[model samples]
Target: MPLSEYEQRVLEQMERQLSSDDPKLVNTFQGRASHGLRRWVLVSLGALVGLTVLVLGAATSNPLVGVLGFVVMFVSVVFAFSPPRRGGPTGVVGADGEVRRSSPPARPPRSSGLLQRMEERWDRRRDERGR
Candidate 1:
């Protein structure tokens, strides 16, 4: 549903008035990027808590539990460092202070024998020639 020009102008005027009337609210809406950040932070904290529990269990005469805790901690650390699917660092602050990166372009469900096929077939022919 596209807005008509009149509706757009009215909405813009309303937004301008509201922003002037309540700058704080406008800033909160535009500047906040905490949803994804909060999720990642909570997951990291959960992993840390679980590791602590395993460590306590290990101290209580379960050596296997201790090993599991160590492994979990390692995995958690790796997860913390792992980049997002967009190839940018997760939990990282960019120039705009947001915790997200430019996302990768999504591949189409059906490739139309475009770039990928050319690359793959080029390598296949090279490999066949080498053999």
Candidate 2:
């Protein structure tokens, strides 16, 4: 059944509140692209090169070359999976001449798990229906 006008208004209000409270949630629902296709292509090419080097090194029985190839593969994998660094100052020197590294931004604390939140909502709805 279609929602009544009042129900629609309530849903809109809830959505507005949610968006204002958690911009991340809004972005997630909008399906924003996290990374570009170019990055993936470069990573794939690096992995391919690493694999070829590894095979060549093994075929020639050169331990040094094999080790270098393995290192390349590891580095490529790390680069691929790592999150892009945000633009910010790496560190600042205090008045005491001590270097302090910048800390990451604090995340909002989650009060309850998804399941708990769902159960609470369900219970609330049941109570409303009973009234």
Candidate 3:
């Protein structure tokens, strides 16, 4: 649910105080990644641990342990399956640092012998008729 106006005011007040008290902590929280390689590696490691636990749980015939292992494995696998982060945008960056997309030429290039021959013939016929 959305925060009430009073609660929002309180939260904003707290945020201001926190920022004033420790700006570095706020920066750290804001800069934390949504996704990246380090995250994938950590999740993979967790998955491995989960697999080990799953095996152990099976050996011990413990339902709770097995369920925990399965849950961890499922979450890790889903998290790890996210698309790789892009290096940068596909567009070229101009000197001004703005991304500029390169467009294809107005006329597409083609080298069909049949088309060339047909054009040549049409031109010759037009010239003959003009004469």
Candidate 4:
């Protein structure tokens, strides 16, 4: 089922918070989040060129040509699968279908919270056990 508008708003708010809190994770997951069509075109072109070269090499029975084609294919495939370059504005598309630009927080978080929370829980358990 489609999310209600309220839920969408909540999700967008959470996304905004996450993006601000951990830009690294946001960047990692969302990539540059722009120029997707261009990226796809480049990948397809690279793969096509690589495949053509491979076929030409096979037809000629040339070891050097074959090796070159193999290298090209390998590199192109790697580039295709690699994450987009980290540049440009970061954005997250909300369920409402609006793109929200999110800038990184001015300062890095002192702690990610999970570790500190776990430590607090551990301390509480230890104290409880002692008592």
Model 1 alpha-carbon drift over 4 Å, by segment: 1-32, 87-131
lDDT (0 to 1) per candidate? 0.66, 0.70, 0.71, 0.75
Candidate 4 residue-wise lDDT, 1-131, digit = tens: 99999998898899767755665676576544457778877878888888888889999998788788878878878988887677745665555545568664468557668989799789999999999
For all predictions, the C-alpha RMSD in Å is: 15.4, 12.3, 19.5, 6.9
For candidate 3, the 10 contiguous residues with the lowest summed lDDT are: 88-97
Q: Which candidate ranks first by lDDT, i.e. highest?
A: 4
RMSD of 2: 12.3
lDDT tens per residue, model 2, 1-131: 99999998887777656654554445444443545466677788888888888989999999888888888888889989997543333343333434346465589777579998899899999999999
Candidate 1, position 116, lDDT: 85
**Best candidate (score: TM-score):** 4
Clashing pairs in 4: none
Q: Between 2 and 4, whose lDDT is larger?
A: 4
Off by over 4 Å in 2: 32-45, 61-68, 84-131
Deviation from native of the Cα of residue 37 in model 1, angstroms: 1.0
What is the lDDT for 17 in model 1? 66
**Higher-scoring candidate on lDDT, 1 or 4:** 4
lDDT of 4 at 71: 84
Worst 10 residues of 4 by lDDT: 88-97
Better of 1 and 3 by TM-score: 3
